[model samples]
Target chain A: MRRRTEPPGLTLAERKRQLVRDELGDAALRLLARQGFEETTVDQLAAAAGVSRRTFFRYFASKEDVVISFIGLVGEQIVAEVEARPAGEPPAVAIREAVKAVTVEDFTENREKSVALIRHTLQIPALRARFAERQDLLRDDIAEALARRQDLPEPTPRLHFAAGLGLLAFAGALKHWAEVDGHADPAAVLDAAFTEAGKAFAL
Target chain B: MRRRTEPPGLTLAERKRQLVRDELGDAALRLLARQGFEETTVDQLAAAAGVSRRTFFRYFASKEDVVISFIGLVGEQIVAEVEARPAGEPPAVAIREAVKAVTVEDFTENREKSVALIRHTLQIPALRARFAERQDLLRDDIAEALARRQDLPEPTPRLHFAAGLGLLAFAGALKHWAEVDGHADPAAVLDAAFTEAGKAFAL
Candidate 1:
């Protein structure tokens, strides 16, 4: 049996790094919310976070990168889940399962914060572009995962199809969930979206 | 039977306007090809095209918008074809036919130019963002067509699914065709992609 290597559970150094990064991101978001994204500067963000100007650059390459810091964790968790699915599952099932596994719990846990961040990102054009780029990365990662499955057919169109559909479900669910405030759990909305997709495809 | 309303076959005034737009776009492309996107400016483009600064702004909102001028026509043609398909066809089939109708002769006619344009757009960040926005428009049009089909179920997930899948195939085919120096016609590549999608989905 293959042993699963878990993510290094936050070492002291790593935990400190994450705390600093989160503080910086929170400061950036607060500024963006108060004074539009275009008006907010790295200096303001650094000062708000109680860090040196250099520390902001240490955490993020650009202001746009800071806006999407959460995506790195989301991407890692989705890829890890996809990689860990049961052997011999079909590509579509595997991708869907992976997406569902990551989103079901995470989205529920951070519904309010997630919605707020999404609204902020959507309102800012540059941040929206970065968000799309992040989604593209996730799509490519899913594609790569599908490509590596030996049980799948050669030149697997299902790989792209599955990944694309999974993303569509994610985007559609997120949009719908954001539109309705205090309606239902975001995970349930995602489940319903997936159920709708499965029915649409008659899977 | 509903009578088709063609776009008034370009009035003389419209023809003159199109001619100027094309000339300006060609001049801009020439500049872009030589000097690269970032180094080129609207003033330089206006001078190269023999147009005033005001006229340049009238024609294109930005340099990035100029790169995506052809997309509006493509979107119109695709949506028209989708809406014109024989009644009672499956939504996916209608979408496939719609994409086929627009791409077949149009893409082949301008094969080299299309490939160069796609390559340039992919290489430029601003152009790629505009391209993605245009693609989102195409997806919305496809979704609208799918939603209008009486054969599909209510609150249709298939519309979203089919639109997303169709765009993915279109993108994948375009990238593949551009990579190969436009050796094969883009329409044929897209057709093959749709066929592959059908097989993948067991549709």
Candidate 2:
């Protein structure tokens, strides 16, 4: 009624809640990269963000959860970009582009910091398991996006299978890059993985 | 000492030791299948096999470890059968055959029981994590076997990526079969998954 066009949905409380969550996530990431995951405590994370320890627990269960939620943004980008791809494009090519696009969009800033965060995340077995668990959620989003692009009634087994196959290649590429300490261009490694992926199937 | 042609290398003591382990594993499986994983106790398992609790811990670290070690046989069969596949076959076809072979060679004995075990395993978050942990080892073995068939000097990242892709399809097929309560021919479902896969790649 006041002629406000911005943020048409959120009430005053929801916006503040989101802002606090973001601040905590940013602080959590900074601490994780600098102090390492195991060394970074929740108290320290909250202190960095100017939030109470209780506030931290309200949003995240642990440092691992914060990191997962941070990178979960990339998963969202992948879905949005896949749906953004031309409908006429083949599902495989769309998937490949969608994966690549997430990096370009989400990782445009803090490239080195993001890499450091990821390196630290993978070194811890618990974090890696948490990350692997997150992938299923990503897989579902990818499958749903691919289905909409292909004009299917719903995400069929084929779309889900292809989505999984593509993500596996993406994961492999990430592993290869991470294993080598990221000396090479990770984007190129991912691109190659996508290109050379289905060659096993004579693609 | 009486010489035996069987197990040409293992000493009598070693042979007997291996026998007890297998017997314990069998008992554990029978108990786990009849009773739920959470409901079954190590003491009950040992009693079923007529072995001591000390003997149970002698082989497995925990109940979860026992189940992982049990299903781990399928992972080994996957590697062995993949390596045994004809070298001339495309890596995709070889992977498909290899996955199918594991089920036939291993699951033929107790298909329903195995499925129940898997369902229970998947339902329990901890068991699912442990099972997922075991899969990385299996993936490495698959990469190595595929490399051997492809005549690669080493398991290249590409081989690993392709192996992951193929496995992803196999997993999708398995999930489809499992979701339907294994009411259909699982192998056919897997076959269809593999066949329909890479159709996204313009195959």
Candidate 3:
């Protein structure tokens, strides 16, 4: 923790590295949006980011790795959002808002590129399987988030089913958004899914 | 349709073939339970089933095919059960019974082998992917079942989410059952999951 209180030079260096990573991610997303994942190369991504090929390698092992990393980051943000919700909030409502936050924060800027990246990843069966596994882990994270704020805890079947239901809605929302070619608003889709899910699961 | 009206000889032949297939399947499950998927081979399965290698091939092209076929049958039975529920019944109740019927009808006999089969299949990553895809399709089937029973038709987001939540409980119950080494009563697990899910999703 003390490392965060760095000298001015180290702070600047860290900030610069983060900026380069973000730029490379943006450049890669632009290429993937225009050209398919296959047509985009790491060299082009490096050049577009104004970084050397070696620097690109330092950040992401491969072109696919960047997309995976982006997905991982989005999932983490959702979990964090869920955890950060008001402790008195209802679990279902908190989960819905947490997922809503993901679309707003992650896709508000360069929305088309984000959609294109989602479509690109959905096209790959292996990546989809990996995504499914992460969703499974995300269920655990959501449960932990809920458990932290409530009496539920790990191994609680109630938590498992609730988390599972949350992810099911999430996956459904994503599938619908991608099916519409991502032209429709994803946040709206998520809103629809969660609203429907709320009514569906209730008496 | 006239095939059913065939003479006694033809009818006997068809019945004999089904019994043989069932026997072969049981034998394969027994072997899988005793040894494992990798350790067991086509030849060994055939020998265990007391059938020739060619007969085993005729029944299943591969050892893996048999497992897939079994899983496919279970999934179909679950869908059928859901579809067969009383039209006036609540969607959640119907889904609960449909999944309960799976453990009852499939596990009443040879309970150990059934557990072993589930564990064996879950151990394989490729099979898990196939299972997830099939679960996606099952969601559609559940929606269709609900639509047929209720006034809601196609494109109903409520029906879609209801189906998704049902599958979520079903999957959680299965995962929990598998985690317990399958010695526990699976029907009880499903009961607990649905109950918890109901309480969790409610306002």
Give stretches of model 2 more than 4 Å off: A1-23, A30-55, A176-190, B1-66, B122-126, B179-187
Q: How many residue pairs clash in each candidate?
A: 0, 0, 0
Task: Give the poorly placed runs of model 1, Cα more than 4 Å off.
Answer: A1-17, A34-47, A50-58, A122-126, A151-155, A182-187, A198-203, B1-16, B38-44, B51-55, B123-126, B149-155, B185-187, B201-203
Per-residue lDDT over B22-63 for candidate 2, one digit per residue giving the tens place of the 0 to 100 score: 888888888877877888888999899998889889988877
Sort every candidate by DockQ, greatest first: 2, 3, 1
TM-score of each: 0.81, 0.77, 0.71
Summarize candidate 2's per-residue lDDT along A73-180 as a digit string, tens digits: 778888999988988877777888888877744443555666666776666776877776667567778889988886876898777767777777777767666666
lDDT of 3 by residue, A1-203 (tens): 33667777477767888888898888887776687667777888899889899999999866677777777787788888888888788777788889888776566566666666677676765456556656666777888888776655453667666677777778778777767766677678887877677778665
Assess the local accuracy of residue B45 in candidate 3 as a C-alpha lDDT between 0 and 100.
Answer: 91
TM-score of chain B of each: 0.85, 0.80, 0.74
TM-score of 2: 0.77
Candidate 3's error at A178, in angstroms? 4.8
Report the C-alpha lDDT of model 1 over B14-126, residue by residue, as the tens digit.
78899999999999988998999989988999999999989999999877888887777777887788877775776667777787778767668888888888899777877
Structure candidate 2, residue pairs in collision: none
